[model samples]
Target: MSFVESRAAIAEALSTVEGVTGYPKRPTTWTPGDAIVLVEQIDHTLGVAWQVTWRIVLLLSGDEGVAIEQLDELLPLITDALQPLVYVDTATPEAVQTEGGDMTAVVILARSE
Candidate 1:
Protein backbone atom coordinates (compact mmCIF):
# COMPACT_ATOMS: atom_id res chain seq x y z
CA MET A 1 0.00 0.00 0.00
CA SER A 2 0.98 3.64 -0.42
CA PHE A 3 2.27 5.62 2.55
CA VAL A 4 -0.82 7.81 2.83
CA GLU A 5 -3.21 4.85 2.66
CA SER A 6 -1.28 2.99 5.32
CA ARG A 7 -1.33 6.02 7.58
CA ALA A 8 -5.09 6.42 7.23
CA ALA A 9 -5.76 2.78 7.97
CA ILE A 10 -3.73 2.99 11.15
CA ALA A 11 -5.61 6.05 12.33
CA GLU A 12 -9.01 4.59 11.47
CA ALA A 13 -8.34 1.34 13.27
CA LEU A 14 -7.21 3.18 16.37
CA SER A 15 -10.39 5.24 16.38
CA THR A 16 -12.46 2.07 16.69
CA VAL A 17 -10.66 0.99 19.83
CA GLU A 18 -11.79 1.86 23.35
CA GLY A 19 -11.70 5.52 24.39
CA VAL A 20 -10.97 6.60 20.85
CA THR A 21 -12.90 9.51 19.36
CA GLY A 22 -11.48 10.18 15.91
CA TYR A 23 -8.35 10.31 13.81
CA PRO A 24 -7.36 13.40 11.86
CA LYS A 25 -4.61 13.96 9.34
CA ARG A 26 -1.82 16.39 10.18
CA PRO A 27 0.48 18.63 8.16
CA THR A 28 4.13 17.71 7.66
CA THR A 29 7.21 19.26 6.13
CA TRP A 30 10.37 17.77 4.64
CA THR A 31 13.13 18.35 2.12
CA PRO A 32 12.90 17.54 -1.59
CA GLY A 33 14.32 14.07 -1.00
CA ASP A 34 12.05 13.52 1.98
CA ALA A 35 8.32 12.93 2.38
CA ILE A 36 6.36 12.58 5.58
CA VAL A 37 2.66 11.81 6.15
CA LEU A 38 1.05 12.12 9.55
CA VAL A 39 -2.25 11.25 11.26
CA GLU A 40 -3.54 12.34 14.63
CA GLN A 41 -6.13 10.40 16.64
CA ILE A 42 -8.04 11.39 19.73
CA ASP A 43 -9.62 9.10 22.28
CA HIS A 44 -12.12 10.20 24.90
CA THR A 45 -11.36 8.58 28.20
CA LEU A 46 -10.83 9.93 31.70
CA GLY A 47 -13.07 12.78 30.59
CA VAL A 48 -10.89 13.60 27.58
CA ALA A 49 -9.73 11.78 24.49
CA TRP A 50 -6.00 11.39 24.21
CA GLN A 51 -4.25 12.45 21.00
CA VAL A 52 -2.04 10.01 19.12
CA THR A 53 0.03 10.85 16.10
CA TRP A 54 1.57 8.59 13.43
CA ARG A 55 4.05 9.48 10.70
CA ILE A 56 5.47 7.77 7.63
CA VAL A 57 8.51 9.03 5.82
CA LEU A 58 9.86 8.26 2.37
CA LEU A 59 13.39 9.25 1.41
CA LEU A 60 15.01 8.99 -1.94
CA SER A 61 18.64 8.47 -2.89
CA GLY A 62 20.35 11.79 -3.44
CA ASP A 63 23.84 12.91 -4.39
CA GLU A 64 24.41 14.38 -0.93
CA GLY A 65 23.84 12.39 2.22
CA VAL A 66 20.63 12.99 4.16
CA ALA A 67 19.94 12.35 7.80
CA ILE A 68 16.59 11.57 9.45
CA GLU A 69 17.55 10.47 12.91
CA GLN A 70 14.94 12.76 14.37
CA LEU A 71 12.28 10.34 13.19
CA ASP A 72 13.90 7.57 15.16
CA GLU A 73 13.64 9.65 18.32
CA LEU A 74 9.86 9.95 18.00
CA LEU A 75 9.16 6.37 16.94
CA PRO A 76 9.12 4.95 20.42
CA LEU A 77 6.30 7.25 21.45
CA ILE A 78 4.19 6.22 18.47
CA THR A 79 4.78 2.57 19.24
CA ASP A 80 3.85 3.07 22.87
CA ALA A 81 0.57 4.85 22.12
CA LEU A 82 -0.72 2.44 19.48
CA GLN A 83 0.05 -0.59 21.58
CA PRO A 84 -3.30 -2.34 21.23
CA LEU A 85 -4.37 -2.05 17.59
CA VAL A 86 -1.51 -0.33 15.74
CA TYR A 87 2.17 -1.14 15.53
CA VAL A 88 5.14 -0.59 13.22
CA ASP A 89 6.17 -4.02 12.02
CA THR A 90 9.11 -3.08 9.80
CA ALA A 91 11.26 -0.06 8.97
CA THR A 92 14.04 -0.27 6.39
CA PRO A 93 16.26 2.65 5.39
CA GLU A 94 18.84 2.11 2.67
CA ALA A 95 21.12 4.05 0.38
CA VAL A 96 21.66 2.94 -3.22
CA GLN A 97 24.24 4.61 -5.46
CA THR A 98 24.44 3.65 -9.13
CA GLU A 99 25.84 5.06 -12.32
CA GLY A 100 22.63 7.02 -13.00
CA GLY A 101 21.52 7.42 -9.37
CA ASP A 102 18.96 4.68 -9.90
CA MET A 103 17.85 4.12 -6.27
CA THR A 104 14.86 4.69 -3.99
CA ALA A 105 13.98 3.90 -0.37
CA VAL A 106 10.57 2.99 1.07
CA VAL A 107 9.40 3.55 4.60
CA ILE A 108 6.36 1.54 5.56
CA LEU A 109 4.18 2.01 8.65
CA ALA A 110 1.92 -0.97 9.31
CA ARG A 111 -0.94 -1.30 11.79
CA SER A 112 -2.48 -4.69 12.54
CA GLU A 113 -6.02 -5.68 13.55
Candidate 2:
Protein backbone atom coordinates (compact mmCIF):
# COMPACT_ATOMS: atom_id res chain seq x y z
CA MET A 1 0.00 0.00 0.00
CA SER A 2 1.01 3.58 -0.43
CA PHE A 3 2.38 5.55 2.52
CA VAL A 4 -0.61 7.87 2.44
CA GLU A 5 -3.05 4.98 2.56
CA SER A 6 -1.06 3.27 5.29
CA ARG A 7 -1.12 6.36 7.48
CA ALA A 8 -4.79 6.87 6.82
CA ALA A 9 -5.57 3.36 7.92
CA ILE A 10 -3.40 3.71 11.02
CA ALA A 11 -4.97 7.02 11.87
CA GLU A 12 -8.43 5.56 11.53
CA ALA A 13 -7.56 2.74 13.88
CA LEU A 14 -5.96 5.06 16.42
CA SER A 15 -8.91 7.44 16.44
CA THR A 16 -11.02 4.71 17.99
CA VAL A 17 -9.06 4.99 21.20
CA GLU A 18 -10.66 6.95 24.00
CA GLY A 19 -9.25 10.46 24.38
CA VAL A 20 -6.96 9.85 21.41
CA THR A 21 -6.78 12.01 18.36
CA GLY A 22 -6.78 9.02 16.07
CA TYR A 23 -7.29 10.80 12.78
CA PRO A 24 -4.01 11.58 11.06
CA LYS A 25 -3.29 15.17 11.98
CA ARG A 26 -0.27 17.39 12.35
CA PRO A 27 0.59 18.11 16.00
CA THR A 28 0.11 21.79 15.31
CA THR A 29 -3.45 21.02 14.25
CA TRP A 30 -4.44 19.89 17.73
CA THR A 31 -5.24 21.86 20.87
CA PRO A 32 -3.72 21.71 24.36
CA GLY A 33 -4.32 18.83 26.83
CA ASP A 34 -4.60 16.41 23.94
CA ALA A 35 -2.67 13.98 26.21
CA ILE A 36 -1.04 12.34 23.21
CA VAL A 37 -0.32 13.08 19.57
CA LEU A 38 -0.24 10.28 17.03
CA VAL A 39 2.23 11.32 14.41
CA GLU A 40 2.86 8.98 11.48
CA GLN A 41 6.50 8.55 10.56
CA ILE A 42 8.92 6.67 8.30
CA ASP A 43 6.21 4.61 6.67
CA HIS A 44 6.90 2.71 3.51
CA THR A 45 5.68 -0.30 1.58
CA LEU A 46 6.55 -3.88 2.44
CA GLY A 47 7.72 -6.37 -0.17
CA VAL A 48 4.26 -7.85 -0.32
CA ALA A 49 1.15 -6.18 -1.58
CA TRP A 50 -1.17 -4.54 0.94
CA GLN A 51 1.41 -4.88 3.71
CA VAL A 52 3.25 -2.00 5.31
CA THR A 53 5.23 -1.08 8.38
CA TRP A 54 3.87 1.95 10.19
CA ARG A 55 5.78 3.89 12.79
CA ILE A 56 3.59 6.03 14.99
CA VAL A 57 5.11 8.46 17.44
CA LEU A 58 2.99 9.18 20.46
CA LEU A 59 3.88 12.51 22.08
CA LEU A 60 2.76 12.80 25.66
CA SER A 61 3.98 14.38 28.87
CA GLY A 62 4.91 12.30 31.91
CA ASP A 63 7.64 10.44 33.78
CA GLU A 64 8.98 6.94 33.22
CA GLY A 65 6.18 5.42 35.22
CA VAL A 66 3.58 7.27 33.23
CA ALA A 67 5.31 6.62 29.93
CA ILE A 68 5.58 2.91 30.66
CA GLU A 69 2.00 2.78 31.72
CA GLN A 70 0.84 4.51 28.55
CA LEU A 71 2.83 2.15 26.38
CA ASP A 72 1.62 -0.93 28.23
CA GLU A 73 -1.95 0.15 28.14
CA LEU A 74 -2.06 1.55 24.61
CA LEU A 75 -0.17 -1.21 22.84
CA PRO A 76 -2.93 -3.78 22.94
CA LEU A 77 -5.63 -1.22 22.70
CA ILE A 78 -4.04 0.14 19.56
CA THR A 79 -3.52 -3.33 18.17
CA ASP A 80 -7.06 -4.41 18.80
CA ALA A 81 -8.54 -1.29 17.34
CA LEU A 82 -6.91 -1.88 13.99
CA GLN A 83 -9.68 -3.75 12.29
CA PRO A 84 -9.00 -5.12 8.80
CA LEU A 85 -5.39 -4.07 9.25
CA VAL A 86 -3.66 -7.17 10.51
CA TYR A 87 -1.42 -6.31 13.44
CA VAL A 88 2.03 -7.80 12.78
CA ASP A 89 2.43 -9.12 16.32
CA THR A 90 6.13 -8.25 16.24
CA ALA A 91 6.08 -4.48 16.58
CA THR A 92 7.85 -2.84 19.51
CA PRO A 93 8.12 0.58 21.12
CA GLU A 94 10.99 2.94 21.85
CA ALA A 95 10.86 5.64 24.50
CA VAL A 96 12.13 9.17 24.11
CA GLN A 97 11.65 12.74 25.27
CA THR A 98 10.54 15.99 23.61
CA GLU A 99 10.09 19.58 24.59
CA GLY A 100 6.36 18.97 24.86
CA GLY A 101 6.63 15.84 27.01
CA ASP A 102 7.54 12.15 27.01
CA MET A 103 7.39 10.33 23.69
CA THR A 104 7.48 6.82 22.32
CA ALA A 105 7.66 5.29 18.91
CA VAL A 106 5.15 2.50 18.46
CA VAL A 107 6.16 0.48 15.47
CA ILE A 108 3.17 -1.27 13.93
CA LEU A 109 3.43 -3.55 10.96
CA ALA A 110 0.13 -4.17 9.30
CA ARG A 111 -1.46 -5.54 6.17
CA SER A 112 -4.83 -4.61 4.79
CA GLU A 113 -5.49 -8.27 4.25
Question: lDDT score, residue 73, model 1?
Answer: 42
Tens-digit lDDT string for candidate 1 (4-112): 5655655554444333322335324223233344543334456543433344444444533333443354345445645654566655665544455534444545443
Report lDDT (CA) for all predictions.
0.45, 0.54
**What's the C-alpha lDDT at position 70 in model 1?**
34
- RMSD (Å) of each candidate, 1 decimal: 12.0, 4.6
Please report the candidate that would top lDDT against the real structure.
2
TM-score of decoy 2: 0.61
Q: Which portions of model 1 miss their true places by more than 4 Å?
A: 1-55, 58-66, 94-106
Model 2, residue 91: displacement in angstroms?
4.1
Residue pairs that clash (backbone atoms under 3 angstroms), model 2: 15-22
Q: Estimate the lDDT of model 1.
A: 0.45
